[model samples]
Target: MSKLKVLGICGSRRDESVNMKLLRYAGSMVAAEGHDFEIFYFDDFPLPLFDSDEEAKTGIPENVHRLKQAVREADAIILASPEYNGSITPLLKNAIDWVSRTSARLQVTDEWKGKPVGLCSCSPGAMAGLRGLYHVRDIMVECGGLVISEQVSVGKAFEAFNEDGNLVDERTSGFLKAMISKLLEVSQALKKA
Candidate 1:
């Protein structure tokens, strides 16, 4: 089978964000399976708030273009989101909003169309950011992404990781692994077709 490129997107911007840690751990697992994994943190690509007038005048921002390229290149995407007020974080929503706009050169959503995706979330709260995954899934579907059914939600995220920043719970780890495997399987099938 051909090697697949997996992109890990973390919605949180904090230096020590639990969501970031979870994404890193997922990347390690994907790498061990012989797939290339790349992590994209929201903090790295600082995009201006999406504005139709600004886009009409300036076109898509360079950073947004780069982000769109990354998404287009990756065989699958693993999204690690932290719920904010029972919905997706603004940082993540903003990034998606920017990417959804049509560009002069590309349909924009074309990059996401039929793309395989895995959703995961981590939080200190009991919901484990699970509520936000629903919103994320809806948005991705609207953009034509094929979000996998399996998902991981690590609750009490403050204690979800150990000293090495690895997931401490076997169940959570297993769930993430299943989600990644499913994503790879679906992506490979789609690529062959």
Candidate 2:
């Protein structure tokens, strides 16, 4: 029963991104559960493409440092992304790449290690960004994150939300809630152990 800090990350940088809405909705739900939830948008902390030489020369960028600190502080993460050509978006992948880099100051790749994560995505296509979650899950595993099995993928995202910006379908909403619950449960257990 310690308060859990959950970080929600939106992959899209567009002004009115469906994926960002999805993430915000999830954050609201998490907050309602009496946990601390904060949303992180890639738009707010843009970073250059990952470059080893640049990292060696100038070290991690300030934005990357800020992002890494956020990830480290959070007990769990929720990633909301849109599928791009059946894969994770470049913005999300680049953020992951930057955070995965070894930080000389920290001397450890601990930002994501053993942290619980929930995956969700929204897209107008039938696949609903599901394929992209596969890649994202793989990357999280490689980064030493403990990804929750339950997930949500909102298909036909253009019509998935109501005028109030809430999910229209009960089934999809249930799946997202269940995923977040599972993430919290697992993270709390890990913290206790």
Candidate 3:
């Protein structure tokens, strides 16, 4: 199997974000499978709140372009975010908004088309941030990303993971593995096709 480049995006600002913990766990698993899995945060790119006026005046920000490049280079992407009011975080939505736009004078926004994306979420509630994942799936699908059907959600996130970023429950860990494996398999198949 060809090693895949998997980009994991954590959409939370908390210093000890459970979302990031989930990504870290996934990253290790991806590595164990002999693939490259990199984790990134919105702050890593350091883009201001997306504003159309600012965009029209200055064009796309350098960070936006850089983030786009990361997405373009990856074989698959994992998005993990906590549910806020039953939806995705504003930070994540803002990033997507910027990345999906195009400047006829600058470039195109075709990067999202045909891209493979996986979704994951964790929350303290029993819902497990699943509600937010649905929203993410909708938004990515609208952007033309091939959102994978198999996703994972961890409830009681504060207690779901250990200091090592491993899920406490074996069954939950299996679900996470299945999701990542499916993502790798689909991405490899798409690359071949």
Candidate 4:
């Protein structure tokens, strides 16, 4: 089988965000699995809040277009989200809104259709970022993505990684490995289907 291209989206904006660090670790795991991985920091996209009027006049913003192109090129997506007030961060939701707008042009007919997805989250709280993953999974399904049922949620994320961003905890690392494996399995199945 050919190598798969996996896109890792760090939905958190903080420079030292635990969620982003987890995503980096996930990328490393994907590489070990003999697949290619690219990480997209949402802060890099600079997409404006979704507005149909602006889109009508200006067409898709270049940043939005670039993000859409990335999504189009990838065979699968892994989302690293952070929970804020028991849900997904607004920044991540805003980015999703921008991507969803292009569904009118692409949606189920073109790119992103039946794409495999893996959900993950990191938080300092005790919930292990489960709420954020829950929110992202629902949104991914709405976008016609085939979300992998298994997820990686890390609690006390502040201490889960080393200074170099490697996952230091054995249990967390194992969970992340399983998550990547599941993502790859689903990705291949979706392509075959």
Local lDDT at 7 for model 3: 93
Against the reference, the lDDT scores of all candidates come to: 0.88, 0.89, 0.87, 0.82
For each candidate, C-alpha RMSD in Å? 1.4, 1.3, 1.1, 2.2
The 10-residue segment with the lowest total lDDT in model 4: 102-111
- Runs in model 2 with CA error above 4 Å? 105-108
What is the per-residue lDDT of model 2 for residues 112-179, given as tens digits with 9 covering 90 to 100? 88889999999999999999999999999999999999999999999999888899999999999999
Q: Which of the two candidates, 1 or 4, achieves a greater TM-score against the reference? A: 1
Better of 3 and 4 by lDDT: 3
Q: Put down candidate 3 lDDT per residue, 1-193, tens digits, no spaces.
A: 7879999888787888899899889888889999998876665677788887888898888888888888889999988899899998988888777778876887857567788998899998999999999998999999999989999999999899887779999998899899988989999999898
| Candidate whose lDDT is highest | 2
Model 3: lDDT of residue 101:
84
Backbone clashes in model 4, listed as residue pairs: none
Among all windows of ten consecutive residues in candidate 3, which has the lowest summed lDDT? 39-48
lDDT-better candidate, 2 vs 4: 2
Candidate 1 shows a clash count of: 0
Pairs that collide in candidate 1 are: none
**What are the models' TM-scores?**
0.95, 0.96, 0.96, 0.91
Q: How far out, in Å, is residue 92 in model 1? A: 0.7
Across 90-151, the per-residue lDDT of candidate 1 in tens digits comes to 88988877766776554455578888999999999999999999999999999888999999
Off by over 4 Å in 1: 104-109
